[model samples]
Target: MIGSEKLVARGLGRSYGDAAVVRHGRTVLTERLDRFLQFDARTGVLECEAGVTINALIDHFLPLGFFPSVVPGTKHVTLGGAIAADVHGKNHHVAGAFSRHVRSFRLLTASGAELECSRANNADLFWATIGGMGLTGIITDVRLTLSPVPSPYVSVRYERASNIDDALELFHADDHRYAFSVAWIDCLSRGGSLGRAVLMRGDFAPNELLTARQRHDGSRRSPTPRLSVPGSAPQFVLATPLMRAFNAGYYHSHPGAPRTKVLSYEPFFFPLDKIRNWNRLYGRRGFLQYQCVLPSVGGREGLIRILEMISSSGSASFLAVLKRFGEGEPGQLLSFPRVGYTLALDLPNRGPEVFELLERLDALVVRFGGRVYLAKDARMRPETFRAMYPEFRTWLAIKNEVDPDWRFSSDLAVRLRLMD
Candidate 1:
């Protein structure tokens, strides 16, 4: 099918955009391809089919002291999706993006050929496929290096920042002391409180830090109850007033002084996963997740301007996050992370107004030498994409060489003219 039809591989559908949707073309689901092919318990090296999910990895290997080297906001994402996005996590400041740990993968090209791709073999294809948004080819399976954790718990410390500058200072001062760090900003706040946030930093809990009962039971956590949104909510459910109230309450809930606690990995990392179908809260119009990274040079001013726009526009986004990135993967051309600060927000799709706000944000990001994350982007313009990712042409060269006919395509690829 790949040889003759325009196609894009879909796995778990976690991406916020149409990267996996081919529009009039075929969509191949990799879910059933799920399988674990190999494992090295001692070295934490494991090879698995593209369909294996972060959730699956945790369930199967957490008990054995291994976890994926990196994870996004959710664990439902498949390995193939992670590689395609080169997803990063709270530890990106240290561990880097997913591509850094990938050893290799088997690619099924459009020419009806299977190629073994890695940093040392078929190296160009290897770099292209990582963060290539699956446009290069179908990733059959992956050899990944899993990280060994001391336990399933994280020793987390929370500190409150009065504003953006405070938050950035806290991050810079302590990021190196922890393996993971992230901040939850109140985008609705303004004036003296603009960008006020609760910064959370953590590292895997060592045995000595675990409670007696926790240590006795391998620090396992009891199953927490899950909640699901039954149906689409009204569009006004996320009104500015309600969002402001929620943000205020959340900001004040955490004490001003820093506090520490040992928490299960679930709450610390995948808090939203506990509420299934949480996107339903955004109503039938859904939401757009805008994630962009601003280089360190002017990131603070950029963030302030961006937040001011969001706050002034009344397009309140309660799920606003901030994180610092170390550097880009050396040879991974299309990967998103760079040495800078990244901000992400969940904006309710309010038709023209919201989109217009995004366009302004995009322009600001570009002015600050930043780029939007393609994995979460849905409405970026072709010219804007070109400006953000100057390396796209290089990636395109490799794509043309491997799939010269442009057999692999997607709605996003077409919209961004990636094939052209």
Candidate 2:
């Protein structure tokens, strides 16, 4: 978005903050850029327009024995957005973030010039764009190294952890054996019962692991409904009582039993993708996803402080996820990955009280040498943001070189003074 002032690079509009919204500014909707430019089945290397989504790629290539090397929970995100955020999946403990799998790409800057960036060439620009959040330029095309898969199905195993300590041991013990993994922690629990969790781990299934019917229809396309949230929902729908009930039911539904089942890529990676406009479920007030990663060294103490803060403040979140992330590429000045446990929470925007509590959480994050995910953040103080992303100065230097006039900007950029 930075180059040529065409400054908006949009994916599925899935980002839960003003980062993806242009407000009154000009925006470039990259969804229209969804098209495969090239593919090499042998090497599993593919090139596509910036707007290409993980879901679209699966539909066209799964039958050919290919899939994203690393994918977040949802496959609806665009290639450009993934790079901009340097998104990670459950397998992060093994493969790191998305940038690792990206070979190279072309970025169109405000001056109407297309520049190639990669580890060996334009290394600085490459790093800045990796996690620059689209501040340096718009991604016109992307070249990524895809991964070979056995079949489109994954063999999944679920294990329940009695508490936080058990969860840690289980994660460390089994992470290497599985290609992908994640744990759903019960953040609402208190005292000795706190941090109870469910661990889900899986690897792509081999041909012999599949049933006759699965092998035949491994390419079958799952129907995706096109729908948006209703204009409004009752404000009372997201009250504390209802949220607590929902959380309780969600926790027990996955009792952590071991089950080896053949699951398709769609259901395993993009369960939420099936529900279009699911955000509307939060109602007219909208919602906010507060996600942060704390370094493992001090992260434990920081997490306890953060959770305790949230519990004491009485903030309610319908969805909360905790995952361990491996080291990531150094580019993308503001990327959100490191050696730590990251947590993401979905809270209905209830007003000033919640924001106040979040501020406290931010303080704890800062104290623990952690940072929030810029892509998912809607509310954060400018000072805190600067402190969290030390590379901001380096990103600014490059952005200024490309967009000195500041034509490419978002509400987030303005709020954080990214263009100043």
Candidate 3:
């Protein structure tokens, strides 16, 4: 691939979509540039190379009573990628996106100059780059404010919701009482059982809340995943029937009343991380993650419509998640989160039919004023993207000013017609 009008910088290869890839040209890979530059133990600010992984930061600082303010589902994402996507966490209703915690970063622009972008300096560039999907510039280093933690464990609560209405009501009733919240939805369930979910809310556990044996050490560590997927999955492994059974089993495993427990941070936040190469379970065709957020104004009805459509189409989603977003980060031009509820699902690639189903879902999302998360996107059309991200034009204006040559681009950018 060569002679493309734009280029892209990629790290860790974590984005489920083509945001980190440039099919028409070579892409910049930044994994080897990783380095920890500095840290302020007093204020919990960390300075690290853009290539540094989220897990690296957690490994080095979680024991020190500090952690990244916002962590996406995976710990494999790079600092630059996280900032580029303006990643959010389960606590999005509270702490906001990762860009909100970023103090400053060194950006190498297309003009062959290094600019220090921050909330107070080069403010436009900062916001544009945060969620611009690496089209603004190549981030070299970052200074981010890390959150202080009482311990590596979390005080968790599990509450089961029987349907869409019940889930929404539970979120409304408990969001203000928890620091972190998320719901695992059963998308295949139809009729009265449609949108059944298990809601989990958590807060960092303090020393006083720890057991006697666990309190022996001042610093506790997050647990490693117990199992790993060894080989490629058989073709029929995650088929419709299996996925339905799995979903049913998972839902039935929950208790009737809200149960509280002290669990390690790893299990509480990243259950998918429990297995290595878990994506392989969907077989060689792989899978696609469709994540969309509907506006709070009419989200309930819109979500129900989407769910009913999915159920009627007989498309099974093995992993479906639902969460509420509080608000958009200030000046985050292309960030995905807003005042709404987000639903994310993993659809196994079964052929042309999968795309057809997604296209229908896209239409509904547009009808209800929602947008798909670009970080997890793989096949959204140009017009669909424009409708979802209303700030595309505004982001483009700043992108042209900073990258007049359109130096930063990705496959996702090209497919969405973000390039000139």
Candidate 4:
């Protein structure tokens, strides 16, 4: 069902936008090539086909004590997709991006020649491919470092923050106590409550930390999703009033008394994963997931302005997440994480109004030295993209040098003018 002049490799199509779609062109579905090539239990290293999904990893290897060191909100993503997007999770402030754990990968270039890429061999290609979003080349296989966990349980702490300031303070003052941390914010709240959020932090719970029943239970393997949305939800179900109510319910549900509890890993990391086809809840128009990072210098102020703008505009996102990102390889050229705050918002496709609000948000992002995550972007202007990611020039030079004719291109690349 896919064929064209310029091609882009697609894995699972969970990128939320045109990154994986080729429009009228050919989109080579890489999922069929999924396979596990090698595994080393002692070293906690895994080498597998690029098409392998995070869900596949946990299902097959989590029981064996190995897990991907980095993951996104959902596990329905492929290893190649994770590396391409340079996905980050609650552990970003600690583990950095997904590329940090990737040992090496095999790249199939536009010239039909295969190259072994890593920090050592074809190093430039390796960095470019890390977060290149399939614009660099087609990654066929990857070798990644995995973390060894005692069990599939996590020790979690919940904190209630009055606003963005309190959340940031808690993150800075308490994040060192855990391995993973994130916040679910209410974008519909204005005034002093502009950033009211629930700060959730966690670390893999040790065997000794788990209760005997929870520990000795033989069904300790990954649990399958028990619920699904079934079909698209009516657009009216997510209007501002309903979303505000939902956000209110979520905020109140967690009194967040700085409590710590042991829970299974599935819900701790991938809560939305329990519900299949959950995206359909946004309705037939779908939703735009806007994710951007603000540098440490003006991050807080920039973030506040953003939240305030969204709240005042009456364009509330159903899911708003905030997190801190630590340092990353500055020389990598294309990765998204910086040492600062990052926010992700999911807004319903309410037509022109949504785009207008996003444009206003873009101005703030550009002024604050922020860049949108290409993996989640659906409607970003070329100028805005360039302003946000000046490193694109560096990555572009590498892409031109490798794929001069521009054989590797996607709808996203065309929209952002990455090839022009």
Using Cα atoms with residue i matched to residue i, what is each candidate's TM-score against the true structure?
Answer: 0.97, 0.93, 0.96, 0.97
In the range 277-376, model 4's lDDT, one tens digit per residue, is 8888888988888898999998999999999899987677668899999899755777888889999999888999999999999999999999888899
Clashing pairs in 2: 1-7, 1-137, 1-138, 3-109, 3-110, 4-109, 4-110, 127-331, 127-332, 131-332
Score candidate 2 by TM-score against the native: 0.93
Which portions of model 4 miss their true places by more than 4 Å? 1-4
In terms of lDDT, the best-performing candidate is: 1
Q: Model 1, residue 419: displacement in angstroms?
A: 1.8
- What's the lDDT for all of these models? 0.91, 0.80, 0.88, 0.88
Candidate 2, run of 10 with poorest lDDT:
1-10
Q: Distance (Å) between predicted and true CA of 111, model 2?
A: 2.0
> Per-residue CA lDDT of candidate 2, range 1-420, in tens?
333433567788766677765656777789999889899888988989989998888778876878888887788889998988888888898898898888999988778789998889788878888877777778888899888898988898877776677777787776788888887776666666566677778999999999999988886876766655656678778877776677678767775566667787777777677777677788888777898999989776777777767655556566777788877664556778888888888777898888888888898898899999988888898999988988888888888888787666777788777664
On residues 1-420, what C-alpha lDDT tens digit does candidate 1 reach at each position?
334778899999999999999987899999988899999999888999999999988988999889889999999899999999999999999999998889999999998798999999999999999999999989999999999999988999999999989999999987999999999999999998889999999999998898987777663543544699999999777889989999999999999789999988888889999998999999999999999999999889999999899888979678999999998767978899999999999999888999999999999999999999999999999999999998898999999999898889999999998876
Tell how far residue 388 is off in model 1, in angstroms. 0.1
Query: How does model 4 score by TM-score?
Result: 0.97
Provide the global lDDT of candidate 1 against the true structure: 0.91
